[model samples]
Target: MTAIPLSWWVSVATALFVIGLYATLTRKNAIAVLIGLELMLNSANINFVAFNRYTTPNQVGGQIFAVFVIAIAAAEAAVALAIIIATYRRSATVDVEDIDSMKF
Candidate 1:
C-alpha cells in the first residue's frame, strides 16, 4: 500500500478550517456558529493526529492533546448552547445579530 504524505493531511485540515471559518462568518444563527466551531475543532484534531502519526509513532501525546481538546470542546458547546438558549428565551430569536439585549 502506498503511504499518504503529510502534506495531504495538512491540506485537508487547512481546507476544513477554511470551510469552518466561512461558515462561522456567514451564518447568523447561533447553532450554525456552533457547528462551524465544531468543524474548526475537528480540523485541528485531524492535524494533531496527522502530525503525531508522522512525527512520533510511539508517543501518544498528539492523541492525548486531541482528547483534551475534545473535552474542552464539549464543555464549550454546553456552555455556549446554554447561553444561546437563555438568549433565545429572553429575545425570542436565535439570530446572533438580532439578540442585542446585552449591549448597554
Candidate 2:
C-alpha cells in the first residue's frame, strides 16, 4: 500500500471546508445548511487528526480540540434542530424565505 502524503490530507480538508462554506452560503434549506455546518466541522476534524499524525513528538492539542469541536457540533445540531422544529410548527414551512416576516 502506498503511503498518503500529509499535504494531500490537508488539501482535501481545505476543499471540504470550502465546499461546505459555499453550500452554507447558497442553500436555503435549513437541513442543507446544517449538513454544510457538519461538513465544515468534519473537515476541521480531519485537519486536526492529520496534523496530529504527521507532526513529530505527537502533539495532542489538535486532536483534543477536534474532539471538543465534535462534541460542540453535536450539541449545536441538537439545539438547532429543536429550533427548526419549532419554527416549522409556527410557520408550517421550512423555507427560509417564507419566514421573513418577523412581525409575528
Candidate 3:
C-alpha cells in the first residue's frame, strides 16, 4: 500500500479549519456552532499528528500536545453540551440570536 503524502493531510487539515471557521460564523443554531468548534479542534489535532509523524528527529512535543488538545476538547465538549442543554431547557430555543436578552 502506498502512503499518502504529508501535504495531503496538511491540505485536508487546512480545509477543515477553514470550513469550520465558516460554519461557526454562519451558523445560527447552537449545535451547529458546537460542531464547527469540534471540527476546528480536530483539524488542529490532525496537523499536530501529521507534523509529529513527518518530523525527522521524532520529537515527542507534537504528539504530547495533540494528546493534551484532545483532552481539552473532550472537556470543552462536555461542558458546552451541558450548558447548551441547560440553556435549551430554560429558553426552548438554541438559536444564538434568540437567546440574547440584554439590550444595548
Candidate 4:
C-alpha cells in the first residue's frame, strides 16, 4: 500500500483555506462568516495532522495541537453565536454592513 504524499495533503489544505478565506471575506452574514472561520480552522487542523504524520509518525504532537484547535474553534463559535444572536435581537438583521455600531 502506497502512503499518500505530503504534497497532496498540503494542496488539499491550501485549497480549503483559500475557500474559507473567500467565504469569510465575501459573506455579509454573521453565520456565513462563522462557517468560513470553521472551514479555515479545519484546514489548519488538516495541515497539522498531515505534517505530523509525514514528519514524525510516532509522535502525537500534531494530533494534540489539532485537538486544541478544535476546542478553541468550538468555544469561539459558541461565544460568537451568542453575540450574533444578541446583535440580531437589537438590530433585527445579521448583515455586517448594517451593524455599524457596537453600542447597545
Candidate 5:
C-alpha cells in the first residue's frame, strides 16, 4: 500500500476552504453561513493533521490542535445557534439582510 502525498491533502483542504468561503459570502441564510463556517473549521483541522503527519510523524501536536479547533467550533456553533434562534424569534426569519437591528 502507498501513502498519500501531502500535496494531495493540501489540495483537498484548499478546495474545502474555497467552497466554505463561497458559501459564507454568498448565502443569505444564517444556517447556511453557519454551515460554511463549520466547513472552514473542518478544512483547518485537515490541514493541521496533514502537516503534522508529514512533518512530525511521532508527535501529536497537529492532532491536538485539531481537537482544540473542534472544541472551539462546537462552542461557536452553540452560541451562534442560540443567537440565531433568538433573532428568529424576534424577526420570524433567518435571512441575513432582514436582520437589520439589535433592538428587541
Candidate 6:
C-alpha cells in the first residue's frame, strides 16, 4: 500500500512547531502559553510517529517513545494548569507581564 510522503509529515510538524513557538512568544496569557506548549509537544510526537512508522515499519520503538512523550505532556499540562489557576487566584489575572514579582 502506498503512503503519504515523509516530507508532508515533516512539513506539518514544522508548521505546528512554528505556530506553537509564535504563540508562546507572543501571547501574554499563561493559559495561551500552555496551549502553545501542547502544540509543540504534539508536533514532536507527530515527527516521532511519522519517522518510526516510515523508517522502521517492523519495529514499534517510535510508537513507544511517542506514548511516553504523550504521558509526559499530559503531566506537564496538569501541573502548568494548576500553577496558572493558583496564579490567577492570587493576582486576579493571568497576564504574564502583570504577574511579575521581581519588580523593584
Q: Each prediction's TM-score against the native?
A: 0.95, 0.87, 0.88, 0.95, 0.94, 0.94
At residue 43, candidate 2 shows an lDDT of 98
- Pairs with backbone N, CA or C atoms under 3 Å apart (clashes), candidate 4: none
Please give the RMSD to the true structure for each candidate, in Å: 1.2, 2.3, 2.0, 1.8, 2.0, 1.3
lDDT tens digits by residue: candidate 4, 33-81: 9999999999999999988988998999999999999999999999999
Give me the runs in candidate 5 sitting further than 4 Å from their true place: 102-104
- Candidate 1 lDDT score relative to the true structure: 0.94
Task: Report the lDDT of model 5 for residue 16.
Answer: 99
How much is the lDDT of residue 9 in candidate 6?
Answer: 94
| lDDT winner, 2 or 6 | 6
Each prediction's whole-model lDDT (CA)? 0.94, 0.88, 0.89, 0.94, 0.94, 0.93
Looking at model 2, report the run of 10 residues with the lowest lDDT sum: 50-59
Rank order (by lDDT, best first): 5, 4, 1, 6, 3, 2
**In candidate 3, what are the lDDT values of residues 1-104, reduced to their tens digit?**
12878899999999999999999999999989999999999899999888787873357788899899989989999999898899899999988889887555
Write model 1 residue lDDT over 1-104, tens digit each, in one string.
12899999999999999999999999999999999999999999999999999899889999999999999999999999999999899878999999876686
Query: Given candidate 1, what's the lDDT at residue 53?
Result: 90
Clashing pairs in 1: none
Q: Which ten residues in a row have the lowest lDDT in candidate 3?
A: 51-60
| Residue-level lDDT tens digits of model 5 in 1-104 | 12798999999999999999999999999999999999999999999999998999899999999999999999999999999999999889999989987546
After TM-score superposition, the amount by which residue 76's alpha carbon in candidate 3 deviates from its true location, in angstroms, is 0.5
Supply the global lDDT for candidate 3: 0.89
lDDT of 6 by residue, 1-104 (tens): 24799999999999999999999999999999999999999899999999998999899988999999999999999999999999889989999999889687
Top model number, lDDT:
5
| lDDT measured at residue 86 in model 3 versus the true structure, 0 to 100 | 91
